[model samples]
Target: MLNPKWESIIRFKCPDGEVHYGEPTADLKSARVWTGLDVWSLQPTDTTRHVAEILAPYEPTTIIGIGCNYKGHAHETGIPLPNHPIIFRKLPSSITSPTSLVELHGGDVDYENELCFITSQPARNVLQDNALNYILGFTVGNDISSRYWQRKDTSGGQACYAKSFDGFCPIGPKIVSAKALQNFQSLRITTRRDGEVVQNSNTSDMLFGVRQLMAFLTRGTTLPAGTLVLTGTPPGVGSYQTPPRFIKAGEVLECEIEGIGKIQTEFTEVNSKAA
Candidate 1:
């Protein structure tokens, strides 16, 4: 499991033009450099540097997603409450920096603000009671989906293809280590599009909490260290809006989690259709 001593981990480039992993200040504008060779096992140095850019925390070993895990979201989308987590995968290549610019592949694009967690060590058949021990940290995520390919005829009702386009998974701002974050539940998660509030809800709405999700996902499956799991989004996604609004290219979406921090993703068109 991850070293519990870490407060938060952020990857950034300093003004001197050297990239390094460090612990961020409350505002995230500066950081105390981590001098250790292995970033996973963090060791702090006394030196602090001005943060020039904050990058994605880390490239995940695997990106696993859970669907219909929020009660309000289920009701809004007309999807029945699931007895188990609806598992899906997004290719690691789709992972992008916190401030990345995504390319729109089709006209139907939507955003799902999700809370994502990373595992610190290999885990298989982990008990719910001990699930927290295996977690490294938690961060903000935007599970970008393509509605056109999500149809039954195009994707055969599977989520991978419709959601695995490049830059589909934008995670981080920084990772607040699991042990450091006292309360994962009830954290306020909100999203804004061009500074307008779009998705607003608390983590309390999730049908399956972090512990339950970790336990369920590990049953008979050996999740590797660095495995990143997107623990579902709350209600208020673009798809379920009254007019069925979709996110368009060149618009910036900011997803913020109470304790973890915020990430901004801007989607751009690469000869794209209307969204």
Candidate 2:
């Protein structure tokens, strides 16, 4: 019975190169602060002192990707519109912060911004009508893809490798409360590269609405609390462009969803030596 709308949590980096975790309060001036070496001298929270990689607000144990859930996207891909939600899984390791870098592995890496719904409770066989009840909140996600690895005869593409790069799934900034999105039936999603507007669409254009998407996913699977399901991206992907495109080192991708907030991440060249 975990309340999805309980106390809000903030994850921040401290000067000592450590990440601090705590509930944000009105008294806290800076959201992210530098405590310096004095961080070791500060008093601990009443519960327990944690001064390491601060746990993410939602420690997602699993993640799923709903593919081509948007009507426009399916048409662009020249694939038949799925009567049900098209889903895939992004490795939990892919999740990173807003300002983090999404590495371009010298391969054809493309950017696809998406809306992610985090689960609040373990659920299976949940009806679409009651889907909202299980949503904890929403966060922005970038589904970096390698088109070469994702293509198959006509259906059933491989994703585990192409979509699971170290920083391929940049997600965050904050998770807006579900209530904040009063009507998910209509949401505006936008993505910009550098300063040029790229993808822009509305959730209303989705071939499968959130409720139906959730129900379709839950039909045969037990979706646990902390599970994140990316609801797919709109058109304007680099892969489908006339000239063809791929993310290169140093490009910035910014995404914003109505009521959910914005997330911006840059691209960096992946070092094969370090990989």
Best by the lDDT measure: 1
Candidate 2 residue-wise lDDT at 20: 57
Q: Per-residue lDDT of 75-168 in model 1, one digit per residue for the tens?
A: 9989789988899999898899898899886558999999998998998999989988899889999999998888788778768988888889
Candidate 2's clash total is 1
Worst 10 residues of 2 by lDDT: 34-43
Return the top candidate by TM-score. 1
Per-residue lDDT of 77-130 in model 2, one digit per residue for the tens?
899988777777878788777667667752778988888888778889889778
Model 2 bad stretches (over 4 Å) = 5-9, 15-29, 32-57, 153-156
Alpha carbon deviation, residue 235, candidate 2 (Å): 0.8
lDDT of each: 0.87, 0.72
Model 1 pairs in collision: none
- Residue 95 of model 1, lDDT score: 90
